[model samples]
Target: MTIHRAHIAGAALASALSMTSSANAQALEYQNTSGGSVTVYGQLNFGYLNFDDGESTTDEIVDNDNSPSRVGMALVQPFGDNQLRFRFETALGLRSSSGISQTEVPDGIDWDRTNIRHFDFAWANPNYGTISLGQGSMATDGVTGADDSGTDVISNVSVSDIAGSFAFRDSTGALTGVELSDAFSTFDGGRRGRIRWDSPEVANFTFSVAHGTEILDEDADTDYTDLAVRYGNDFGDFNVNAALGARRIQPSGSDDEDYVIGSVAVHHAPTGLSFAVAAGSEDGGGDYYYAKLGYARDFFAVGTTAFSIDYYEGDDINGAGTSSDSVGFSVVQSLDSANSEIFATYREYSYSDGTATSYQDANATMIGARWKF
Candidate 1:
């Protein structure tokens, strides 16, 4: 199958390129300085492209290859007599991320900087709440959906878009696309500048709400809104977290616009087990769900191998008219956090009533070093 070959190819590619080493960067030498401060951190991942879903997300490479990886910096400074604060994070490596198209997918895209990997500023102690601004993911973005589907736009679903997906379609089948939740992608406020609030939690439960105004070119558009509630706790050997989230777009009009997502996760670490369930509504009018179960233990008590499994499905697309499911597993090994091995994942999808079907899986083996200051 196409999906199977893609996985194997990507794996072979990753295996060949996985031979990597990076000199350790000195740690952030904090002098306990008084005024405002700046901090930075990022990672670079280069590997073979062995994925067989017959759907190469970015580019269809023949075998093992080298590629650009993630790199970013965070900056913070105080202004306005300590009343105002600004922070911005940007990147050149995100082209390989899940939210947007990378040069990796065959004959893929080329993006320029200032695409705003992320930017936000906060003025604290405001009347309604902390006034903030940015094009980053809003409060409900991760709370209600699959937050880190490989931390890449091509692999994850965007919670803000009415379309709610990054996977794209080619003449033969479906291929993954950039996060697509970006400012220019679609739907007002789908991904835009906004401010939000945090109602101090009571009885261990918290509340948050945020709204954005889509910048349709320099003209701007109607307000986009997101609202949600969250709850979590750990008692004895049991731990739990749950979130109920939703988003409504172009509040000014009620045409074909709407999306919803819900999620719950639990862990029983004593037994090395965990589970998660997430569901969403993208139908402009329908619904869907994704789930996972995982277990971990030292393979033969050597601390060299670990494993997990994940399953996913989406239905009643935010208005796209499609539905599908995916299941995956991963193996990992570590000699301390700096040096580790990761082998992951398989996902397959069946379209509406067998009208269409596509499969995708990833096999990545990497050995790298990381040092933080």
Candidate 2:
């Protein structure tokens, strides 16, 4: 795999931050005499993107879709041994990198109901666990993204989020109409209008299940059912996190699709090293494997500095006899004083369709900052 020299330069620049500022980063909160509290929180992520589609290059400012900018509010009330919580969150709906392409650069902001991430309420009990209702995460959400690597702000198993809409080029330098998003997928679960339940933790293990449908999109009629198990623990100098999940999607009048996905991550505190692996299989469709190596340390008093490299491989994702693969390098530096992070990433994508037609690889580079308040 070829690493872009420009990306290395960008990483160096991103890592060279020396600015310091007073921190006013606490979430805005209000408390009522009734022993209830409401907290407001949000974050903004902005970035510069450079994409090379073999035939040409496109550069633009974008809202990093890797995380996106968003706002949210949480309300909590204690009831004996149980708690009642409500959350409302949505994306800012800026022009995101995942939505941009060589042929299309969306203009202005486009806010819609689809941007709603969580509008849900939950009741939690230490004995029975928690139950949630409304538009929120399904049981399998984040099941394929259990990573202890601090560099996830810029790199993860979801490789296509960076430049997903950019089309691939044929050997003749012509657009092949096959976008990275179409060719690569992690089969991870997502958020939806649903009812979910979680079992109380037992020896660091927890179980969850959910049932839901597509509610934000009026014309869509899809039902989702999922279950997941997660484990997390800190073993003195080492920490580990893992998850396994299964989901079934049934579209109106369409065949059902089933998926199983899992991931594990381990971090060694003394050495500041980490490793993560994820894999998934779609019933009769596609399968993928991903691995990442990472290192992190508090090289500066401000916060931790992290670096990571990852690889992904997929089989039959777009169609039978097709393959998609990618490699990525990333770095992230935390600015504790400002409650923000500066990050950079470089990635290369390749695909094959089992045909005689040859295609050129695509490269993407991004440098971004995320600030939370």
TM-scores, each model vs. reference:
0.64, 0.92
Model 1, 1-373: lDDT tens digits are: 3224333543443344432222334212111134444333433333333323335433222111111332333333444443354544333332232322333342233445434545667665523345567765565756643232221211222222112223434446556442223211111123467776655566777666788775424555567677777788887886778877667777454464566667777777677676767776644455656666656555553344545565555544423554544454544443444432333333343334224443233222222222222
Q: Name the lDDT value of residue 138 in candidate 1.
A: 61
Each prediction's whole-model lDDT (CA):
0.45, 0.89
Candidate 1, which segments miss by more than 4 Å at Cα?
Answer: 1-32, 53-85, 94-115, 123-130, 145-191, 215-222, 251-256, 298-306, 318-321, 334-341, 353-373
Which regions of candidate 2 fall more than 4 Å away from where they truly are? 1-24
- Give candidate 1's error at residue 134 in angstroms: 2.8
lDDT for predicted candidate 2 compared with the true structure: 0.89
